[model samples]
Target: MSTGGGAHAAGLIRLLQSADFARAFTLAALGTGFASLLIGRTAGSVTLVTIVIALDVVGAAILFARRDELTLLRFAPTSLLAFLAWTLASTFWSFDRASTLRGWFELLAWGLLAIVIAHVRDTLQTVRALGDVMRWMLAISLGVEILSGILLDIPFPFLGVAGDIAFGGPIQGIFGTRNMLGFVAVMALITFTIEWLSQSISLRLSIFSLTLAALLAVLSASPTVLVIAVAVGAATLALALVRRSAPEHRRTTHTAIGAVVATVLIVCWFLRHLIIRLLDAASDFSIRADLWNEILDWVRPRPVQGWGWHGPWLRGDDASAPYPLNVINFTLDDRHASALNSFFDVLIQVGWGGLLLFGGMSVVAVVRSWLVAGERRSIVHAWTPLMLVALLVDSMFESFTLTGLGWMMLVVCAVRAGQSRSWRERIRDLAEGAPGGHGSGSSQDPLSGAR
Candidate 1:
């Protein structure tokens, strides 16, 4: 190659490795990852996947160029890598290797996006990026709902707009379902709340953002939204109590709160029927129960390794598709993308072992995030734990956490949590201080102060 050409290529690489470029890439990645559903529904799966692949490729190039600035030990959480490895390993025994391989690629795509954001941005910056993305996506969703339900007075079947906003709907918005919209709204509520507490955004804008999220959450009419709202509210209060306590007493307080929460969960489980009736979700629960039962029947045979990771159970409402999930739906005379339960989805896909890994990853991330949130001085630290709580709570009723924006958010939270409090960080710290240690203490701080 000519000297000029070489210099030009080197300059481009340097540009890609710059901090400014990293920040912009993080924001763009968040926007694209969060809008996966809308993109898929509006354009097509092929288009959505193509965009993800393109973004992943660019993110990879940037990360590669900036490799020297990153600490290899802290690249990602061990639990997350284990879960991903198990997911990839499932392909060997998959009923459809090609489909499983594609699903794994999608998983890696989102995981890579989350990892890039974690490395490039601190908690407050990440929160701001998400807040911006949520504002636009939520606004677009509401606008689409308004356009279809009012101006056009017609359903946008392609985008999953049912024109139900005129009736004060159960509106699906740009998300494919009312439940998904509700889930995103809950996430928006959390992000907006953090943005408000941190004062990263304007007071007027925060209020407006909060109002938008609350309105869509209500209009979406998802029962899980109500449950998630209550859970997050309780968590906020609990976190506040923990934060205000004396540092020495926080551990005791944590134990007491955990005990109370455990007791309440047990009681709620026993009274679940009454709660279901109160939420007017009996019908929805019944439908989900049927799907769960069918999924269990399929899971029993492959209880060890599962039927393998097939992601979203295959597209289309075709009964003759011969896909396992499609077959289950056909048997139940229902049409759904997932089993409607994240745990069940994991169990049926990667079996009990995969379920354990997924659960461990979630539990560890939540614990780490929760402890850090209570201990940290900045309120911004609370965002990760609160978001994880909402994701896990909603996972019980909807399998949204298994794919799309839900999965991306889950990965981001887990990565952030792991960065803040993990054995890897502790080991690196020790190594940095050891005699003759070459460690430069260059590991990125996930909570590098509030913005």
Candidate 2:
């Protein structure tokens, strides 16, 4: 039985590697996106995502064999791996050890999928994969909303959506919430904008994508999404201006940026309430403040290591058990509140030690990716780093640092941005792209099947 299973697995992998099955990458990529973003957790969906992730692991393993052993470390950041290790280690101390173990596997599966995306020979290819996956996701999501609100003339109760089918829809589509739709739309805007700037896709295609993204942004009516869109625009404009600056004027450019940042921070600090008002945020932001206070109170005792990555604590009414850190009834299937801040989320789950590690990971990913973008001189590469920046910014409101699509995207960006290749390796990549070179090997640019 074991031999037969192994043989079947090998045969499947070989099929994926074959030229005729080149579209296999697209199918796998779309599955990863849908499993993480479009579909919610159900027994059937869970089984599907698990199988898709398993297949993705096989594909990743095949691609991993092509790169130099040393370069493989670039695919997994030290902080990220450490965080995962720590999270797993916490199971030893956690009251709900079984739950912690399950959560760890779930999180690691997403990380593995990201590593697969990072297998690309260049950041441009990585971005291309992202664009392809998102194009389908956003397009289908919009279609679902239209179907629910317009043709059906009712909410998609199954999807947990409620709203009219009008352009400014309250519709949640397949994402189950307007804010989630808004978040995806903003990301789509970023992807499409970069595709336009890099000339990676045709003008018509880019315009169409932009139109869909903009329309969704308006319809979703998510304050956080709109804020993120503005931030993305600001970041893009800033990158463009810096890109156009004379090489010798970099020092001056840095100084100007610092001043601008300082001014913006000061203005935001004084007008914090006004900012919240503009976004139509709830006065208490749906109990986030209350939850944050509870978390902080509980975290005071174990400032260093805290409750051992405990998940949805105190599921029952037993008083002896540690109360949920977030002050919620764990028995409830739907959770409407979180720490609502990513930094706090880390601090709550992993304590101060985990917080520092995550911070280091974020810093290394951003700085390294920024440097590589400059080296490649590809606008898409430049755009790649921005994705991480945008994720970090988005994290400020929604605790998106771990699990799901945001987490996976951060992992992909980190692997691509922080790569360090020698001159010999650079020459090899150029040669590999040449007509007569070892053309299109698995180790170098295997995912360019679409291109």
TM-score of each: 0.94, 0.82
Per-residue lDDT, model 2, residue 64, is 47
The per-candidate count of clashes, in order, stands at: 0, 2
Worst 10 residues of 1 by lDDT: 435-444
User: Where does candidate 2 have its weakest 10-residue lDDT segment?
Assistant: 437-446
lDDT for each residue of candidate 2 in 169-288, tens digit (9 for 90 to 100): 655656667766787777778878888888889999889888988887788877788678777777677666766777678558757875997899799889988888777787545566
Where model 2 places Cα greater than 4 Å from the true spot, the runs are: 1-23, 35-38, 41-45, 67-70, 284-286, 310-323, 326-334, 420-451
lDDT of 1 by residue, 280-347 (tens): 99999999999899989999888979988977885554423225776797899876778788999999
Structural RMSD, model 2: 6.2
